[model samples]
Target: GGIPQVIARSYLAWWLGSPAWSPDGSRIAYGVYLEGSPDGDTVQIWTVNPDGTHPRLLVNLGECRAACAEGLAWSPDGSMLAFHSIRGVPAGTRAIYTVRADGSGLRRINRDGLQPSWSPDGSRLAFVRFPTPGGIPGEITHGELLTMASDGSDAIPVLEDVALSPNGLAWNPVG
Candidate 1:
């Protein structure tokens, strides 16, 4: 591998995380944290060219009561993006969402999910669902791994009642 190079940088004091390259490898999608905004620290999705040009905002998850959007995943066809957002206060409800790459058709797929990963064929999405009552309380010791149709239907737990890492989810391309 060649020496690392910085292709993009956040303006002002915003922070960046959750970088996901499009399937075509032409654009990079990531979450930007607008720190100290009047509405609090909110996270929005943005895309930039591989060479760091034509930066565009794809999704603005307005006013996150707590932690907002993260764990962005691009569809196999590079037409859509999936991510998880935690909203509300004290309780901090979590949900999975998807939007077109052009910044439209934003939809919440799952009411309770995190760390979304699209299937290699782009036909399904897998995510983590922590148990209630203790809802992501400290280290996750009990949760379920679920997969659903691309449009968020027929969700079924592939694994349950296990200690799951909130950030661990992926699909084997060969599968």
Candidate 2:
């Protein structure tokens, strides 16, 4: 049973989104709203030592026009972080991206997907889509779930006609 407790809230910066712990448990990385956030033109990633001494800003998504970061994951090896964003590059598009845990070499991994979950081995990710380029919302249509490799190759349709939201899905950590 592994559950994390938010002992200290991210307060130095007001805009705090998803938070993921590094594999080594030395630091935590999360998305933060610099000044505008959610409605402003900027959102970014930041990290702080567990003792809360050395806080640092990792990646800024404001330039991409994304407003907020909602989901985040840490690579098993602690070398990288995978995160879901509503800002960056194309702007306003839901996507997945990764960057060094220390805030270096940020890159976009997926351009159009949502609800990113990393594989146990950290070599692949699972996500959901809106079936038909924006499938019927409200559970009115049947669209299967999808999966893809970490490099954005071999995007295979693993499920069929399940549901589509382009932003939501149901998955249990354990089955």
Candidate 3:
């Protein structure tokens, strides 16, 4: 491995996490949390060139009352990006959304899903679905693994009643 290099830095951001490389490796997409904004603390999605140049805001979550986005994934052809947003848009629970690489065509895919992983062919996505919190406080009973068309239709559970890590879904690159 080569020496690590810092490509992006931010003093205004509360934190930056979930960096995803575009399929062509030309750009990186990530989420940033900015505190003390006019809309209070908010999370936004951004993209930057691999060389740390031409950073651009892709999605602004400031409109959501209290939304944060993470778990970004790029479509195989680099035409779109998928991410999970908490309390976004419809503003209640976490959901999956996609947007064009140029930061347009924003759309929600699944009403409840997280950590989306695009299928090798980019025709489908696999994600985790944690059951809503219940019973004792701060206790989660289990989660399910699901796959659906990239358009968010025909979702079918692959595994249910299992402990699935929120960020554990990944498709086989070779498939």
Predicted structure with the largest TM-score when compared to the true one: 1
lDDT of 2 by residue, 1-175 (tens): 5666453454445656666778789888777665544545467777878766677877766644333576677766888887766554444566777787767888787876666666667677777665355432233455556777877677877776774554444345452
- Candidate 3, 1-175: lDDT as tens digits: 7877777777768778789999899999998888877767777899998889999999887634433677899999999999987774444677889899999989999988888889999999998887765211133458888999999999999999885557546888886
- Taking all chains together, the TM-score of candidate 1 against the true structure is 0.88
TM-score of each: 0.88, 0.71, 0.87
Least well predicted 10-residue stretch by lDDT in candidate 2: 131-140
Candidate 1 residues lying further than 4 Å off, grouped into runs, are 36-41, 133-138
Cα lDDT for residue 130, model 2? 56
RMSD of 2: 4.9
By how many angstroms RMSD does model 1 differ from the true structure? 2.4
lDDT of each: 0.82, 0.65, 0.81
Task: Report clashes for each candidate as comma-separated counts.
Answer: 0, 10, 0
Expressed as tens digits, the lDDT of each residue in 1-175 for candidate 1 is 7877676686643667788999889999988778786767777889999778888989888766444668889999999999888885455788889999999999998888888999999999998888664445245668899999989999999999888767757899864
The superposed Cα distance between candidate 1 and the true structure at residue 67, in angstroms, equals 3.3
Ranking by lDDT: 1, 3, 2
